[model samples]
Target: MRKNFLHFLIFIFVFCFSSFSKSETCGGADGLVCCNTITSTSGSVCAIPANNKYIFTLRRFGFENSAGEVTWVGTETSFNAALSSVGASMGNFISGQSLPEGTYVAVRPEVKLEMTVNGSGVSTSDSVACTSGGDQTENLATVMNNLSDPIPNCSSSPNEDCNTGDGYMRIRDTQLGNFTVTAATARTINFEFDVGSGVLFTASGGNCAFRSMGPLDVTMSFSN
Candidate 1:
């Protein structure tokens, strides 16, 4: 009986140690999935897109109008181009779920913005700085037309917030301007879920913002 009890205790100790070791090696700078805080405006947490391509759903909060069903826009090599491909679905309801993993050959249908404002307002447009590939060279121009003035408010400098007209602003990736996104940004913007060492999804051109009534819910997906 004593020998059996000793063996049981040893097994428990080994199990506990193994679990603790796994937890320590699962997240943050030491590993991936850093468990950062997703916030308003693209930051370490919020702006950082999903690194790998996986099926996902988008949920919108506090929308004034009844959101239509999810739809697909088109697939471009990056965010700077236009509808390279289109899907066969469209509706007026929001709340997208269970998108399969693929190239998303169209504009994701559920580009809904959530906020508490009226009509439309300007949102601050800023580039997270990404690589100079594809349509990246025109990212800035895309931002100016799509997101600035008509979309989100822009600051003369980086340390400014978008006016968010009436507490509501819409933001989206454009195909105009471009920059080299940071490591964190690259990991998050997983359109293909297969970014090369120096490739990333860039926000530029006319996809910077959209017409909305509140803070935006830019839920994107990843593909291969």
Candidate 2:
């Protein structure tokens, strides 16, 4: 009997130690780190605008299982997430939505491809400055589809273009990291937009006549 009791105690110690180690390695209040970074290479030079705004519509939020199936939750919502040197949040779009008790391998978010970016850029040819006027909304789907097409001039001016009145829309599926949900668990998910090097400026017709979207870094963090 004494030997059996000793073995049980050893098992408990091992279990606790394993759990603690996992928690430490994860390095968050919760045991999961669901962070993802996204980038694009559409521009020659990357920069951060003085006042950058990334606007998009959150069509749906869901979770992916190990078998690559998604279970969706939440309603459609629009978010105008302003990004800066520090980064910005899109708020809790999934609030009040409950997920079934299960382990999810990834997060799937359906968003509109239409996004608006507000920033400034300089032309490398003649050191000319360019602006999107105030904000330029473009369809990423269109841009992606027509990669070889010539970039439209922001204005008719030879030196600078500042038209900024374009809009388009499409839907896209974005998948982030993995997480698990239980009946007793309370989760907090944060969508961080890092635009440190997101704006791009290019020369057109020997002048700073075009301003286009650049690389963007997005991070999604989950905690309790």
Candidate 3:
């Protein structure tokens, strides 16, 4: 009986030690999922993305609409871009999710923007083209063109926040494909998920951006 009891105790110790070792591996710097805060803008993280699993669901593109605006963020869903060849690179991460470094075909979507404030406004547009063009506009544009809602009380930067006036915005549906992640000592690809029409925004020639809500904790990474 004493021998049996000793055997059991040894087994327990081995099991406990094994579990601790596994936790230490997963919680290390080269781990999969992380608790680090995903910032409002594109940045780096400690984990690789593809090593994780999904709590999958339909990620339909929709707007937060007025007071629901706080929910717009970049980390909830993943975006895919089809490249013509392996040499393609997405310039400046191409405005969304962390993609493997190399040359990417298209980064920013081609769209027009017209943001008007109390009186002043800005207008810009761009042609849609890739290594091949197939009209990616319907893929992710979240716009509220109706002038029905009462505009909010203005109190912010006119360029970044348009509290009143007619507004229009759209996101090109990202083409889905299997992408190659160039090997690195460490790298990250992130997408700007927070989107909107007339809140805090940035207007260039063909791209319009509002302040992002935030990013989720999952990442998609690949290796050599």
Candidate 4:
């Protein structure tokens, strides 16, 4: 009788542990989606330029709860930096902050549409190498201003599909589904930026001109 009771207690503990572990899902509409490549039409391609430097400002960062309400973690401050420089530094954005204990499903980041892209890519139109004169800030406010979606739409079927002339821009939001905040512990989010297919090149006046800021591969991770 004592052995049977011990076995029953062990079974109950295992079942409860499994149930609690399964409740925390890390991906979906409520979590992060990392894409390394852009979906493009035929004859249109994306590549990392020789010197690709993407600079933008992060305006706001926060998390969304299951109730569709957002819980902001920090003040509205301009964090201007190059895309390559935002890896481990992302943790600083939420430093010294605590979230209300709840299950969060999404990450919200308000970014300024004005960005600078400096790189050189082989033009799909004529296979010519095109490069930006320097770091020229392009205002993408017309297409991506105040856009909630972080994933950009770069599926336009054209020779310059990834170029601004064709009105192609890549933006997509990162989801963090069902992330529960317990005890308001210190948390950090890590980011990996893959610029392999981040720029599209086109021939302009016998020189390479930036057509548009192509899809940027961004992978995000969270830890306590």
Candidate 5:
């Protein structure tokens, strides 16, 4: 009887330890979605198909006002491995939300749109307003400035996405540096992001319009 009780207690300890040691896998929505900016002659893209394990949906949209384009293209790239790697390493991947630990997805989708605004939408010299997300939308310039270099109140200011100056822009997962993807599904890097903006840019000012670039619902998948 004594031996049986000791064995039972040992079993329970091992069981609990094993369960606690297991790393949570991906399955449901990780809750955080990040977006990176890329310039395109085609135009702004919103959504990309969710077929790739790591999906990086690229969109190109410039801010416009009644006067003209408030924001112009500085730079753009469709294939950025290093940036994607940083994305892959970060982000919450659980068993219920997001992809599984070793799951392999193989399709990439892309969409485009544009953001046009007015003079009132931008704020050139309002530090207090720019710092506050609530007061940043005074005009197209303010909105674009806020998007690229928002002066928000947080332990860390000026999110990583906007750290890089110039035409370069990116919005990464908020969970970055706090989350990790398992080595199994981490073999290939996949990324995805959704962004919205109402900022315009121009040397001076003119009638702003992105018109319509239609949608390029293209699907791309790779099998391992």
Candidate 6:
């Protein structure tokens, strides 16, 4: 009897330990959704997809307005450079062009969108993250900041996406980093942003905008 009871107790301990050790995976509406700026290099929180579909967002670091917030004006142009900066392909990928508007733009039957940004210390910055789980999981491990290709307008709002809540973005699954998004589905994404005045670059602004180019949005997708 004593041996049997000890075995049973050990079994319970193992079972409980396994269950708790498992990282909680989120899905469905409340589970897999959207996210925003994440400053920790330790990796941000993300929803685990159920199947094949995945979604995410990215942005360039810039500052706008006296308060400094993320703006949309330089986003389209800078994201591409961000991708390449992380050592991704640049073939056929062009900036400044909008994703072709249409259906199937959803990319997969189920997708999860995640975006991320770094913090500026003093004041807390903001970010956004969302998931569309039916048969999908948020995979963000593949995403990385593009330090190479430079955006033309970034000089204006250097801290746009990172320092301020302006362009708040988030990473999907904290596991996957740096991902490639095709035009077919990419066109469907509607990125709405605000570009504050007197923050961008010009002949007079000179390198002021360049120094401001700090953080940007990192996007990624996952497979089944």
Please give the CA lDDT of all the candidate structures: 0.21, 0.41, 0.21, 0.41, 0.21, 0.20
Go through the candidates in order and give the clash count of each: 49, 0, 24, 18, 46, 59
Quote each prediction's TM-score: 0.17, 0.56, 0.16, 0.55, 0.21, 0.17
Predicted structure 3, TM vs. truth: 0.16
Tell me how far candidate 4 lies from the true structure as C-alpha RMSD in angstroms.
15.0
lDDT for 170 (candidate 6):
25
- What lDDT tens digits, residue by residue, belong to model 4 across residues 179-219? 66665334444344444434444333444445555443445
After superposition, the stretches of candidate 4 with alpha carbons farther than 4 Å from their true spots are 1-45, 50-52, 76-84, 121-128, 141-174, 184-188, 203-207, 222-224
Candidate 1 residue lDDT tens string, 108-138: 2222122111111112234323322122222
Give residue 81's error in model 1 in angstroms: 29
lDDT of 1: 0.21
Judged by whole-model lDDT over C-alpha atoms, candidate 4 comes out at 0.41
Candidate with the larger TM-score of 1 and 2: 2
Per-residue lDDT tens digits for candidate 2, residues 1-224, read 00000000012111010100010111112221111111222233324442346566666665666666667755677654443212112233443444565666766565666677675543243345555567777766566546774333335431221222343221222343555555555444444444433344443443443346543344445533
Please give the range of 10 consecutive residues that has the lowest summed lDDT in model 5: 1-10
Question: Which candidate order results from sorting by TM-score in descending order?
Answer: 2, 4, 5, 6, 1, 3
Please list the residue runs of candidate 6 whose C-alpha ends up more than 4 Å from where it truly belongs after superposition.
1-50, 60-91, 94-163, 169-224
Task: Show where candidate 2 strays beyond 4 Å.
Answer: 1-46, 83-89, 121-127, 148-177, 186-188, 204-206
